[model samples]
Target chain A: MFKAIITVKLRPSILDPEGKAIEHALQSLDYTALSCVRIGKRIELQVDLDDRAAAEAAVDEACRKLLANTVMEDYTFELQKA
Target chain B: MSKVKFGVVVFPGSNCDHDAYHAVKHVLGSQAEFLWHKEGDIGGADVIILPGGFSYGDYLRCGAISRFSPIMKEVVSHAQRGGHVIGICNGFQILSESGLLPGALLRNQSLNFVCRHVHLRVENATTAFTNQYASGQVIEIPVAHGEGNFYTDLDTLAEIEDNGLVAFRYAERDGTITDEANPNGSLNNIAGIINREGNVLGMMPHPERVVEQLLGSDDGIGVFASLINAISGDVTIPGVAVLP
Candidate 1:
């Protein structure tokens, strides 16, 4: 078995509306030191695969098929043997 | 009468519901109704649209809070049964958040709310939504949003292309959708995509804004026309005709 941890995030250039709203809220609260903020998702998966290569392939398939949308989100994974 | 009924979902912060409703009723001359977010049902419409806007004040992420609305549950069930669903801008974000569509809408690469007229290359004409457009045809549409950046892994990107799920791509004046013309730095210059069933489409551009000549261009008429035609059995997938 193997465990896969996936980190998904938006590209760097796109506007982060949630982040901006939070920044605005922080400013309203008199918190002026913070400059920027971005939000992302993290997912973990456990698959009964034998090899690292197979586990990686499964993670990739899951991300493409449903976990991550290629158009708006980027995802990377780290695999470890169980 | 085409007998196709369209419904536009109106969430608390949805700003483009009226525009989309008019696009369907006036431009397509069909029966279109407004659906509130709190409603339990979608009124059994043929096509359900999630209009653009800052739904739920874009809190907890663009569409995060809106995803849990009473209406979204029905929308998800409807979509699973192969109902036609289209999400534009913030609607697209809601779709992602509700898991009706894969992937997430992130901050734009430029870190600004981009509002401009952009050229898009039709990548897949086989879907119900893109049947009116010719594969590879370039059309101009207006986009206004902040978190429109599209992201996915390289393998998934390739899969989307291979499966013909990519509906439209951002392009330049030369009709080439390349990295340079990519406004939000989306992977593969993708501007729109369809779900695996090919029944749901999510795009950032506002087709409703370009449907009338008074809006500076009627390029978006074909898109709306295509959807109407799809229901009326006037058009078919994989047809051989170039779109302007």
Candidate 2:
């Protein structure tokens, strides 16, 4: 089995209002020198496949089709034998 | 002219389907029916409405899962054929996800769910959906959503403006576009936009909720009236060459 860790994040050009709100909370709590705080989602799933190449393609397809919306978000994934 | 048929697609968790159906059938005096999401055909409807709601509980992202719904296939085909399609709020998000419209709706700048009536200036009144209203007319409509901040690349924004695809813009009562009047921080104060062909429109406001005078303001009736007029050949839409 292969395990994939996918991270989806809003693109740098897109505004992250939730992250901005959290940043304000951090600043209020005296977290000074904070440049920025952009939040994203991390999805971990296991793929039941034999070859690493096949598993890579499957995970990539999942990200492109369902896990991430390429219009406003970017996604990256790492695969490893489980 | 044959009576227009409006199809309101009811996706899982769509709360505004009834409102849309009522707006067309009772308020506008048209034939209206609900089209289940699992259905692949458009049910011979002239206008398709992707009503507002938290479809699929807005999992992953707003309108993300619903875009893959079976009915969306027909919806896309219908739009490609130059049939009229309007998506309001969550419907707008779905249209964006389905590639029927451009840009994505991000989280509101305030990080809160905004629900209230706002002024909208008719930016382009020549489209099939806005032909009843004069260009620059300000109409009052209610917007209810948490993710309505419209975002797109600078190049695409310029292209949308250059193509005159913007249908409505947030404005003041007297029709002044201002930052203070923008409810969701939509790019360029955009509240609604149409496809390049002008048959598909995705907007973040609920025009159906205000279709009757008893519902506070009847300004929204123009939206329905415009569509009925266009479909009945009472109004001519320029630049759209939909071969029947």
Q: Pick the candidate with the highest lDDT.
A: 2
**Candidate 2 chain A: worst 10 consecutive residues by lDDT?**
A12-21
Candidate 2 stretches greater than 4 Å from native:
B234-244
Chain A vs. true chain A, TM-score per candidate? Answer: 0.78, 0.91
lDDT of 2 by residue, B1-244 (tens): 2289999999999999998998778776788989999998989999999999999999999999999999999999999898999999999999998889999999889888999999999999999988888889899999999999998888999999999999999999999999999998999999999999999999999998987667876777678778988898643323221121
Task: Looking at model 2, give its docking quality level.
Answer: high
Question: Using Cα atoms with residue i matched to residue i, what is each candidate's TM-score against the true structure?
Answer: 0.74, 0.94
The structural similarity of chain B in model 1 to the true chain B, as TM-score, is: 0.94
lDDT tens digits, residue span A1-82, model 2: 9889999999988878788888999999999888589899999999999899999999999998889989899999998789
CAPRI level of candidate 1: incorrect
Task: List candidate 1 stretches off by more than 4 Å.
Answer: A1-82, B234-244
Candidate 1, residues A1-82, lDDT tens digits: the string is 9888898776565556667788889898989997687777888879898988878888899787566655556788898777
| TM-score of model 1 vs. true structure | 0.74
* Fnat for each model: 0.38, 0.81
Quote the positional error of residue B233 for candidate 1 in Å.
2.0
